[model samples]
Target: MPTTSSARLAALTVAAVCSAASTVVLSAPAHAQSVRVHDIQGTTRISPYAGRQVADVTGIVTGVRSYGSSKGFWMQDPSPDADPATSEGVFVFTSSAPKAAVGDAVTVSGTVTEYVPGGTSSGNQSLTEITRPKVTVVSSGNPVPAAVTVDAASVPGRYAPDGDSAANGSVNGLPLRPDRYALDFYESLEGMNVRVADVRVVGATDPYTELWVTVKPDENRNRRGGTVYGSYAAQNTGRLQIQSLGRAADFPEANVGDTLAGATAGPLDYNQYGGYTLVARELGALESGGLHRETTRAQLRGELAVATYNVENLDPSDDTFAAHAEAIVRHLSSPDIVSLEEIQDNSGATDDGTVAADETVGRLIDAIVAAGGPRYDWRGVDPADKTDGGEPGGNIRQVFLFNPGRVSFTDRPGGDATTATGVTEVRGKAALTVSPGRVDPADPAWANSRKPLAGEFVFRGRTVVVVANHFNSKGGDQGLTSQYQPPARGSETQRHLQAKAVNTFVRQILDVQKNADVVVLGDINDFEFSTTTRILEGDGELWSAVKSLPRSERYSYVYQGNSQALDQILVSPSIRRGDGVEYDSVHLNAEFHDQISDHDPQVLRFRP
Candidate 1:
């Protein structure tokens, strides 16, 4: 979700201080010194003096956040303590525009508090801050503290230590080794000035004015200059989030593999979004990585073309219809059949009783024709009211659109919005008893999720089976930037079952017809290398078409510094072993800020 306008305003103040060269003197009452910022922010995650009132805490104003709930300025001690475990800088929460300017030496009196941005229930770590501050500026025009270098060599080789039980996620209560663990590295430099040089962009720049970069490119590196997210064990410690504090002008429009010419200098901050962020004021120029939005693949003669795309909650009210249609017609070469996900009901997100998506699909098909493409016919069962979970009342479900001139859908009897379709053998060939039917609709794995839409098509007198799916998303899972070490992926369990359900249904069809041209594709919500995909492709029953591409080019989605495959097109043995089968992930959306959706559409071309 995007940050609120008020929060962005607060971040802008911090960015202003980062770019500020001089500070002006202001008349204010002076107070006697008592404690240092290092003492307020101890080695531990929580503040030692939390809930206690402290008098005359002395430090220089480094940066200020003038909006949001915890609006305040960061203060740093000019003379630091000998202990390397403690941070010299601390945030003063004023909850409004601060009176102190950058580089001002001042004394502050306030109550030390530990603030969790998303509240206590979120399981996120808290930031130590001084609230309700009484500030008195004693001097101005003082030089700010120099930033510490944080390169690959400065970062620790390991991320976190293992624990015996699930409760103990990582080794805690240890001394801060900024050079050892990535979490400790960020914690030690919390609220302090830091610099990362010659970094490569691993994550695309987001609309929230932030991007992630990889400082240790030599370790766990991809050919595109990104840090590959291999699995739970090899968490990439080199990746770091870069935030301009909502400074739109300072933020660059960058994609993965892009490089920064010079060093990015800023203060280290811990937030709810991505654990540790470098709120930089001065970022180097962005250099191109020779990456471009890919064009449509050449259409093969006498081959059936199919595609899978997540249109990102398309409804009657969305104005992205024309752009999406253009992408399908021009960039996708107008595939013979297209599998789509997230097609909302007629009323979109309104909590009305409207459940039909006729208006939505009609508008999209009309736009495709208007874009000089083939007129398409669509088929899908409207999900039961309020059963398929996705934006409330959106009634998001999978739908198939086929060119009537080239392919015809074999619609049979006994399919409904709720009933599951059974596999049956007809004249010694496996087929769906009810074409355009739901796959295991009542399965527990599909509860509150979109069920797979199965459709049998006859193109050029050859039978083709396509299953459109949108599995449960990866929500409620611990992020890589979480304080917990080896973050838990609790969401993958449901997806595993969902994959198994689809695989079993496909096996039923392949059982009777050994050479069936079955294609299972859509947003599985897991990586190509994930356990979910592994379960779907068990024992080569289904082969992921994405693996046909090179390692660096097998991505259809970019998330958190990893260009991984979330949207995939997996084919059966017949399609995998057949000649002249080509696959390409048309990378027009995922790598750009003006993307219509978070996922890129994937196409599979083959002669059945």
Candidate 2:
């Protein structure tokens, strides 16, 4: 549902164009009056008179947008509608520059339509609009409808309604519950002016001139000022996307927990990226949360530092290598070993037969060394052609980069890209039969997905088994702002299976040596409190290093206003109980617009 960063960027452009269209003015001849906006926007998700021509729809122009192909202006009825569920305002899609001005009492003749942004194939709900309009400015300088208040207490707890069983999980067929459902409340205020107060920024201000805020306080709120994406709790009930479409300046940069001091006024809108957004023209004063990019963690003398970072599909062709290298050196304190995910093949995303990532991995190592970090050695199993699901021929896989001077690779024979590595007893200690090997490469859980890359390293006379992983993503899951009730999370099923596979492998190492030092690190693609994480830590066999930090400082990623942990560093119980096992989520990325990756690197430091 357009959860990717690119999708957010695209939405930003679309919102900007639409906002420009809504605020700009043009000239048109007058036409006769027809239907009320409330009659067109009934108490349902879909317009009742969709596809029918309605004449003389009268209202005061509240907003005008004249920039994009889907240009429109918002109009609100001065009088009232008996049904509170029905909205008194509506958007008139002029399909060009709008010919109306704010506060102009206008009459329009048009066809009522439910135009789905991004078309019907996008799985997005349709927006009710009046298209092919004939506009008549009946009178100018009329008072517009007063904005309605939509704060935490006034907002409904529920987000969706259960539709008919035959409607395929959609609430489109259901009657509106404006006072009970957040989606219904938004639909009720569609095109009408509304104000949100006492709002806390849940999502950081992104490059797209948009931000996400929550009217209600969350349980896992970070002290630094962002809501932790804890287990699926409130379902983002109070979270709202704020798009300053018609503003003269870009929205100010904000971190999680920052507050908007005054009320933000705008018309509620539905778009492709997020389901419902506030197309704000006026934003209140922003109160800072004192959130800033964190500095690199200190590497202690006796501590062996380990970290996990998702490079967000790095390839030899991408120019982000140098910036990423600097972040690894300066922001992550040059960990002794780093688990890198999403290393693409040498040819990048090209669908060629080339599957090796030597060039891709080598360039990063060179960049890291050039950036004043340790000269590192790397090991990884290139996936079998394109069987691993990723950017097709890009063949994204996890790899380990270790500082050769500090740690030695336990290089045993029989390691390849496709063979599964087995645990064996060696000299009365836990050891992998092949030092750099795949963990159950052919396992069904890893079908069409990147397999776990297992490597054994020797640090200060002690052996540490590090398993690097990049599991399937949440690509197929429905967004929290979906029209479907209890949004589908189908992607978690694969992740759940993948977690079990990794957990079983960890169990194998523990069975050989109960006190074995094992660290599972990479882009796990799930939260610490998620089911996938719980399965990976089955029976407390391993401990998540993130929990080592206070509850308010455990996020490694941010999306749609929620700061969450997706990339994780989990250590076996022995490591957790060991001395000097400190953990930190280095926030050089994720919270900033000029980020190197969508994920923040996490480090676990301990003396084993």
Candidate 3:
């Protein structure tokens, strides 16, 4: 006969056991390792630390919050770091409305995932890596019980009041407890069931899908022997998450974070060799989608190519058109679609006292063609530059130039104001139309990006979409960080917004286009993982051309100590590996110390 306190604890213990048994399995990128998706030796059942998965973080629900249709509950250190590790508060969302709040400890297990750019406020950036939210609730704490401390290292492998010991451990990625980054202060929680806070995903792509959680100082790092747990719901993706569970704790319950005397979840299932195996389902999704693989061409086969370059403030000559034309020529080369960002209204004040919106494109075309490629008859520029370049009440920054024999104009170009939600207007980021040759709406994504410019192109009987863009730069009137899923503080707001815009535009436009094959080339002004770039990866179906480049050739520009993919050539799923398309980034500009425009040129070749 147990006392009232004992009975309550028993109930909690049962819930915890059940919660741990359930884990959700979803499609995502993987770690650079080949974690065997099986059980470990002598562990008797399944092992939770073998899969690229998440944990069922259960703790007192200290508080709750609201954000439009999405809401969240707060929890004190969900997973305590092994030592010296900092623990951020954990926030769990149910639906659009939060169910718990400060002091109301709860347990949730769901797939851990990255934030999509579409839902961001400051737009999107490439600064922050990834973040995950709570999707499922295993149990709710009324006045979320205070967490109990467990020193598994000093105490022993299986320390418990009743000789029942459990813990968790990690080989790679998990902070070694002495780090100053997010996971510092925690060695590893091998077996014990400890709640973690501020849980988020770090890596993407197929093999680097890793989860990072903020730990509390008192978190358990022991090696527990039982079924492990974690998850992030599919429908919830980055927002609503429900912790994974197996069989709703069949036994009695236990107190929050308490060292159980004889608690154990049965039939553990391990995968990937990490600390957790995903349960089959979580949150509102019975299933979800994963990476889609397709075959591409092996070689370019020497086809003529086209591309764009964003020459930042390309005013070459002091003699207006002559100097402007000459100075710009220093950075010029051969390409199809050459984009200009920051060209003077006048080629240097033009001949007439009035800088007739500087016909930079028209002149550059003459020089580049005179410089010789195939033919330079066609031309396309944004803001139309008829009035000499001032953007009315704004400034002119983006314009495009295409060789007539190489490509033709679509004339469906337009601009909009820049914001977290859509592309920029006022010359910040603009889009123009052109025909790659197929001359048909191969896909609906001819236009995509924060300030994307779309056009139609025909390649060897196959119609496709080509989008050119000049996104907001790292230097602009944007915040340090947008109010989005990324918790990174380093990336600028405008950068993030542009990233989100690219991501949202892709997912919203290309993802839905049935037969559309989309490709985007632009100066995103961000590094590979910058929050802005992340949106492109997380949401948009865009794949980086850099991935195809060797490490030495991966970088397009250099700034500060970091070399980034500021300029990129991305393609959608459908046209990923078409027969005749060839992609590459040409070094026409940039290197922290090198010459050329602040950016280089990216070229693509396909039969038209």
Tens-digit lDDT track for model 1 on 47-118? Answer: 567666788998887776665554778888889988877898887877667989888999999777666544
Report lDDT per candidate.
0.81, 0.81, 0.36
Tens digits of lDDT, candidate 2, 1-608: 34333345344333222342322111232343356888878878777777677898889987776654546788888897789888988888776678798889998887676766654544566677877789999999998778888877877877667656687787876888888887888888888888887688887776666788887775356766676776575465777888764642546667666788888877787776677777776787888777677866677778899999999899999999999899888888888999999999999999998889999999999999899998899988878888888987888999999999889899988888778899999999999998799999888989988999999999999999999999898986777766666677888999999999999999999999999999998888998888899999999888888987876687889888778889888999899899988888888788765677889999889999
Candidate 3 clash total? Answer: 143
Q: How would you encode candidate 3's per-residue C-alpha lDDT over 1-608 as one tens digit per residue?
A: 33232232232122111232322122343432321111110121112322234344455554343432223444444444433322323333344456554445444554332221222232321111011334445445454333323222222221111111222111122222222211111112222223322222111111111111112222221111101111111011111011223223321221111222221211111111121211111111111122121112222333435555666555434233432233333333344455555555454434333333345556665655454433454322333223222323123444555555545554443322221122222232222232221111122222221235455543443444566666654432222122122223333565555555556655654434544656667776665545555667764477766666654355555331123467777777655566566666554333211233556566665543
- A best-first ranking of the candidates according to their TM-score comes to 1, 2, 3
Candidate 1 at residue 561, lDDT? 76
Q: Which of the two, 1 or 3, has more lDDT?
A: 1
Q: What TM-score would each prediction reach against the true structure?
A: 0.91, 0.88, 0.39
Q: Which pairs clash (backbone N, Cα, C closer than 3 Å) in model 1?
A: none
* Better model by lDDT: candidate 2 vs candidate 3: 2
Error of 1 at 196 (Å): 2.7
Error of 1 at 112 (Å): 2.9
Give residue 51's lDDT in candidate 1 (0 to 100): 61
Off by over 4 Å in 2: 1-34, 118-123, 157-169, 197-200, 217-220, 247-263, 284-289
